[model samples]
Target: MANTKAKAPPIIDFAPFYGTDPTARQDLVAQVRAACLDKGFFQIINHSVPATLQDAMFTLAHEFFALPIEEKLKVDANLNDYHRGYETFRSQAFSGSLRPDFKESIDFGPDYQPDHRYVQAKHAACGPNLYPASVTNPAAFRTTVDTYLAAALGLANDVLRVLALGLGLQEGYFEGFATDPVATVKMLYYPSQEPVAGEGGDDGERGINAHTDFGFVTLLMQDDVGGLQVFDNDTDSWLDVTPIKHAYVVNLGDCTQRMTNDRYRSGLHQVINRSGRTRYSIACFHAGDPEYVVRCLPRGIGGEGGEEKYPPVSVNDYLTERTKDSYIRAEALNAT
Candidate 1:
C-alpha cells in the first residue's frame, strides 16, 4: 500500500498582471482571488526583483551566520529595544509548542532615524537595526540587505494593488494602509538535522513551529533545500512548498484574514530542515500602518447579505499581543 497527497502549492505567473491587455489583468486577478480563498498561499513568478540582488543577499546571510558564536553576539537581538538584531538558535517557541524552534535568525524593520518620531517614542516595531561588526564586509552586507528590503517592499505594494482589484475595490484601496507600513525582513538559517539517540527516529525537531503570519502579508524566498510545509485545511495534511528559482512564496496574514472577514485565510505553515545541507531563507512581512484600524471590507463583510464577521481593531495592538505570545522572552514589548 502507498499514501497519496498533494505536495505542492499552485504557482502563479505575474506576467499577465503587468500587461496592457485588460482581459489578462482580470484573469490574473481571478487567479489571485481563488488562490487566496483556497489555500491563502501561492508562488509568484516574474516579480521584478533582480536575481543578482537575491544572490548577494543570500551570500551575505551565509557569511554572517558562519561567523563564530561569540563574534555574532556583539549585537544580540535580546538587548535591542526593538526586536532588530541576531537571535541565537532555539530562542523562540511557538505559543502552544513548548519546544524551541531549531534555527537562528536576524530581524530588521523599516530604517528610522534616531530622532524619528517612532524611534523617539520607542515604538515596539520601529527603530534602527543592529549590524554585526564582526562581519568581514559589513558595508556590503548592509547595502545588499537594504537593497533587497526595498525591492521586496515594492513588490508587496504591487501585490496589494492587485488584491484590492480582485476584491472589487479600487486598485489603490490598500494604499492608505501601506503608508509608512510596518515592514520587517528576517533572515533565517536552519542547520542540518541530527539523529536523536534512544529514539526510533530523528525526534522530529521543527525549524519553526506551525503558525500563521501575524501581519497583512508575507513574501518568502527559500533556497533549493526545501523544508517548508503548509497545512491543508481541506485534507488535514501538510503540503510541501518546494522552492522555485526566482519565485517567492506569498501568503496572506492574520490582518488580511480578519479584514476579509475570513474570506481570505492565513495559512498555517512550519519549517523542518531535514536536508543534509543547511537551509537559508529571507522573509518579508508587511502589515498595514500600525495605527490603522482594520475592519472587514464592505465587499467581504457581508457577502450576499450576511452580517460582518469581525470586529474592528488597531493593527499595532493586535500585532503587539501576537508577537508577545510568539516569543518566550519578548522584552521588546516594554517599549510599546
Candidate 2:
C-alpha cells in the first residue's frame, strides 16, 4: 500500500536567527523566505518560549473550557464591542461557510489603560480583557495568559526581523509599523468529534471552516491532538500540519499577502478534531499599527518596473472591513 501519512509543513529553527552569527542568520532568512514564497507556512522550533509556559497555557485553556456554561457566559464576547472575551461554541464562521465553527474561543489583546493613546483613539482592537472570576484560580489564568501573550509578541517581533532581512530591508524596517501593533491572542478549544462524518464532509459542522487569516502574521501553538490542515494551491489538496514537540506553526496572513504583492500567499487552513480527545490551541495575531498605511514594497512589486498590485490601505480599515464581513455572514446565517 502507498504511504498514507500526510505531508508535514517545513520546520525551521529560530536559534540561528537569534544568534550573533551573520552568516547563519542570512541562511535562515533565505530558508524562511523560500518557505513563505512556496507555502506561506512553516513550523518554528527553538523559539525561546519555555515549554513549561506552553504547558501552563494548555492547562489554563482546558480548565477554562471545563467551566460550567453559565460561568463561561459571564464573560461572553458578545457583550463587548471590540471582540474580546469568551465566544461560545458555534458562534462565528471562518469565512464563506455560514456554518458555525465547532469551537469556543477567548480573545484578548494588550492590556491598555483607558487613557492609553490607542484606547483614547478608540481603536477597537486595543482595550482591556475580560476574565471570568467564576473560574477556579482566576489569578493563575490571568497570569498565564498575560505571560504567554508577552512571549508570543516577542517571538513575532523577532520573526518580522527575519522577514525584513529576507526582503533585503533594514532589520528594523518593520519596527515602526509594529510599535503600536493591533495584536490579539486567542485561546481555542475544540471538543472531540468522534464518529465524524465520512471523508470530504462539509455538513456545516467543521471544527473550523476553511479560510485565510486576515492579519499580518499569526503564531499558533497547538497540542498533540492534531487535526490542522493547510490547502496546497499547487496540489489542490489538503496537507496535514502535524504538531511537533515545542514548535509553533507560523503562517502569513491576508495583509502580508497584500503587502508582498501576492509573492507570499496567505495560507488557507482549518481544524477538524477527529481525535476522541479535545484539542486546545493558542494563536497570536500580530498586525501593524492601526494607523499605519500598508503598501506593496518595491521588491515585492517585482523587478523592471513591475506594477503595484495592491493600493495603500490603513491597517485599521482593512481589519475593520474584514471583521464586518465575517460577522455579517454569521449573523445572516443565524437569522435564517
Candidate 3:
C-alpha cells in the first residue's frame, strides 16, 4: 500500500515553498514575480485544504458520477433553468478544434434568489442550481463542497495577495475586484478510456480539448491518473502539469490577463486519456463577475499598454463571443 501511494501522481515542486525560514517568503515573492511574468501559473503548498479533504472530494465526486447515465442526465443543463447540473464530455466542444473534454463535469455557479437572477448584456452569470434529488448522499455532498469552497476562497485570497506583491502593488490592490466574484467548483470525472492512437485521432477524442481559462484564476486538484498538460509560453511546448501532493496548480485566466495588460499570460493546452483508467479532479475558478469591465492594468513599472491592444470590454461580451466561436467552429475545426 505504501509503495502504491508513493508511486501515485507526481506532485509539482513550487520554487516558493522550499524552506521554513521566515525571510524565505521574500524569495517566494521573487519566484512568483518571475512565474507570473512568464507563465502566469504556479503550484502552491500550505493551502488551507488538507490532503484528506482533497482525497474526500475526489472520492465523493467520482461516486456521484458513477451513477447510471440516465440518472445523471436527469440533472442535465438544459433541464434546469440555470446551467447548473451534469454536462457530458463532448457537449462543450471547447474551441471546436479538437474533441470535447472526455470528462463529464458537474458545473454550479453562485446561487442566487429568483428576484436577484441577473443577466446583464455585460455579464454571463445569473440564476440558481439544478440539484438532482437523485443524489443519494446530497447532504454529505453539500458539506464536502462547502468545506472545499471555503478553502478555495481562503487560498484564492492568499494568492491574490501574492499576486499583488508580484505586481509591485500594495497587498490589497485586488481586494475591491474580489468582492462577490463568481467562484465556481466543478467536479469532473474521466472514466478510463482507450488510448488516443489506439482508439482514434492523435489526441484522445474523448478528452478535454485545448483551451485557456476564462476567469481571474483557475485552480485544479487532480488525481494520480496524469493527463493534464500545460502550454509553456517560454518554450512554446506542451508539458504535462504533474500533480503534487498537498498542492494545487493555479493558472491565470483571460480576464486577468487582459486586466494586467499582458503583464500576465493565459495558457492553452489539452488532456489525453492514455492513462487507461478512470480519473477525477476538482477545478475551482475565481473569476470576476461577467459585467466587470477589463481594461489595461496601470502601466507603470510592470505595466505595458501602448494604446491597449485589447479594448476595454465586459468579460460577458468576451466570453459570449468566445462561447459562440466555440460552438460554431465546433470541435476539430480551426480555432477562432
Q: Whole-model Cα lDDT per candidate?
A: 0.83, 0.83, 0.70
Ranking by lDDT: 2, 1, 3
Model 3 scores worst on lDDT over the 10 consecutive residues at: 1-10
Winner by lDDT between candidate 3 and candidate 2: 2
Q: Give residue 292's lDDT in candidate 3 (0 to 100).
A: 71
lDDT for 295 (candidate 3): 78
In candidate 1, which residue pairs get closer than 3 Å at backbone N, Cα or C atoms, i.e. clash? none
Instruction: State the local distance difference test value for candidate 1.
Output: 0.83
Per-residue CA lDDT of model 3 for 73-151, tens digit only, reads 8888767433567887666667544555567888766665466625332245445666555677777777777788777
TM-score of each: 0.91, 0.93, 0.85
Candidate 2 backbone overlaps, count: 0
Pairwise TM-score winner, candidates 1 and 2? 2
What ordering of candidates by TM-score runs from best to worst? 2, 1, 3
- Candidate 1 residue lDDT tens string, 228-308: 999987678889998998799999999998888888889999998878889999999998788889988776432423567
Q: Is candidate 1 or candidate 3 better by TM-score?
A: 1
